[model samples]
Target: MKRRSLILPVMLFALLALVPLLATLGPRSFILAITTRIVILALAALSLDLLIGYGAMISFGHAAFLGLGAYSVAILSSHGINNAFAHIGCALAVSLVFALITGAISLRTKGVYFIMITLAFGQMLFFLGTSLAAYGGDDGLTLAQRSLVFGAPVLKNDVTLYYVCFAALLGAYLLCRAIVASRFGRVLRGIRDNPVRMQAIGFAPFRYQLTAYVLAGMIAAVAGVLLANQAEFVSPAYATWQRSGELIFVVVLGGLGSLHGAIIGAAAFSLLAELLSHYTEHWAMIFGPILILVVLFVRGGLTGLLGGGR
Candidate 1:
């Protein structure tokens, strides 16, 4: 990548690293809490960017993986499996299976059919979650405590948790950056633009696209693990269509195709929503127009506004 491309992500991470210090100036807990949520969601958004931006697979059921990750943590913790490694392992395994199966079926279709199938799969998971009465079902489940780190309550400290999540976000960003620059990423993008042409050159577009889909799902599941730890709760609402839509909005708001744009977009969307909700309960009404204006006028979302072309 060019030095110019590194500039924005570097600055973004530097500011994020300073956030705990900045929290001392204001509502410390509130600042740490909200920013942590932003980081986690940004991770999720980043994964979606891998699909939508590069793979051109508009997955409407993306939040299903998020919900799956959160539930993995919640359900395991409830069963006395509080180990962080176990939670992560279970989440990844579940997400991998779900993504592989769904991607195989979804990739066989195109355009609106693909979108609707993803949506259908997401709703199927949502209803399944609500049916899990043993895990609180529609009511949601609260964690007894955060996942243990080698039998220690290391993540219980707010600041420690914040840095852990920040590190995960940074790591996920780097992983995605590497993937996008790799030969596999190139094949995926080629498939996105012209699958037939790619096939003519001996590349199986289905396999590449399906692999990318599975990878994106697994990454988003990790975010879901962090989210469960952050919120200390899990609910079926996490997999709802509305939540999936918001992830798409976050990607578009940040500028599609650019990994760093997802981070900037998540920050903008979360912070803007936080600011708006305090003044009015009807914030979505006002926020809707703002997003519409950006979609209509802004060429590439907030990242574009910052002079970073997608």
Candidate 2:
């Protein structure tokens, strides 16, 4: 990787590491809460970057994995399976199965077809969540408690939870950085630029695309797990198409194909929403125009602006 590329992630993580300490100067609970949420969403956005940015696979139903992960925690906890590992395992297993089934079929198409199919799958899960009346249905479900670590309330502390989430974000960034720098990542990029040319060179685009899709889904699902734990609630709204759109917006806002860009975009999006909403309920009206301005004028998104172009 270029030394310039390392600059952003290094600075970003270093700043994130100081958040807990910084919180001591203000409303610590609120600070930790919002930051934890941003970190989790950033992880989700990073996974989407792997697909839309690197693999050129645009998915409109990526939020389904988020819903799956959240629901895994809710359903399992309700059934007396309060183990954190169990919830994570369930999320991964479910996300893997869903991604494999959906990706296999979605990879056969291109352009808008891929987008629509993913949206359809996401809506399917959303409707499924609404239909689960036993789990509170459209009203959503609240957890009696957070997941325990080794039968202890390790996550009960706000600061502890924040650090755990921060660690996950850091680890995920490294993992994705490794993947993007590997030979397989090069193949995905080649396929993104020209699938026909990649095929001519003896690479099967389908397998590579499908693999990327599944990996993205699983990673997003993990984010969902953290989100559920963070909010202590689960609802069908988690898988809504609007949420998926936000993820896309985040990746684009950060700059495509740049991992750390996702984190920057997520933080900007969340902080802007938080700040704007405090001033008026019509914050989205303002948010929409801001996104348009960024899309139109930001060249390569925030990362490009900061890094002097990708």
Candidate 3:
């Protein structure tokens, strides 16, 4: 990639890093909160882009990993195990297992069937969360405290948490970029473009695609861990089909196959929804049409307008 290609992503992160200083000048603390939320969701959407953009897998249940991560922290914290490493480990393990099982089954199908199976699995997890009465069930669960970093309340501070989220986003972006540029990425892209040809050449597209699916799940789970801490709560709704739609929208709105597009899309979607909700409770009623117009007209997404390609 050219140095100029990185300019936008670098500049965007720089702007995000400065947000804490800007928030200090204003009395509205919600600015920092919402900003953190966007970055967290951006991480989740970035994971989805890895599958949809690079692997040509349109998963409709990616939010299940997010919910799993959040619930992992919540459930573990409820048991007096709120260590950051512990939460992350549990979240990743569970997401990996879930993704392996679901992806193994879902990848057998193609196109709309794959989508429906993923959606079905996500809904199953959503209902499972709702059934856990000991963990607040339908009412959701609140954390007694955020995950502890070496027994310190690092994430308890908003600014510290914001930087942590920023670091995670940066790390996720770099890792995804590296993966997409590697020989493995080439094979995945080849599979996406021509699975039959790749199969003829001795590459098992199923195995490669499943690996990508599991990796995406694990990454999304990390976002969920941060999300649970940010909100200090976990809910079944986090894994709903609707949340999956929002993730897909973020990946698509930013442009498929471009990792940076996921970040941009998340930021735009979060800000747009925030602005619209103040005017009406049924904000989606308005936001829906706007999103449709973007998909219909913005052929390459916001990234295309900015002159980047996958």
Q: How does each model score on TM-score?
A: 0.99, 0.98, 0.98
Clashes of 3: 0
> Candidate 1, 288: how far from true, in Å?
1.1
Better of 2 and 3 by lDDT: 3
lDDT digits (tens) for residues 1-310 of candidate 2? 7777687788899999999999999998999999999999999999999999999999999999999999999999999999999999999999999999999998888999999999999999999999999999999999999999999989989888888888988988888888877999999999999989999989999998999999999999999999999999999999999999999999998888888889999999999999999999999999999988988998778888896345
Q: Per-residue CA lDDT of candidate 1, range 20-123, in tens?
A: 99999999999999999999999999999999999999999999999999999999999999999999999999999999999999999999999999999999
Q: What is the lDDT of residue 96 in candidate 2?
A: 100
98 Cα displacement, candidate 2 (Å): 0.3
Q: Considering only N, C-alpha and C atoms within 3 Å, which residue pairs clash in candidate 2?
A: none
Candidate 1 achieves a global lDDT of 0.94
Each prediction's whole-model lDDT (CA):
0.94, 0.93, 0.94
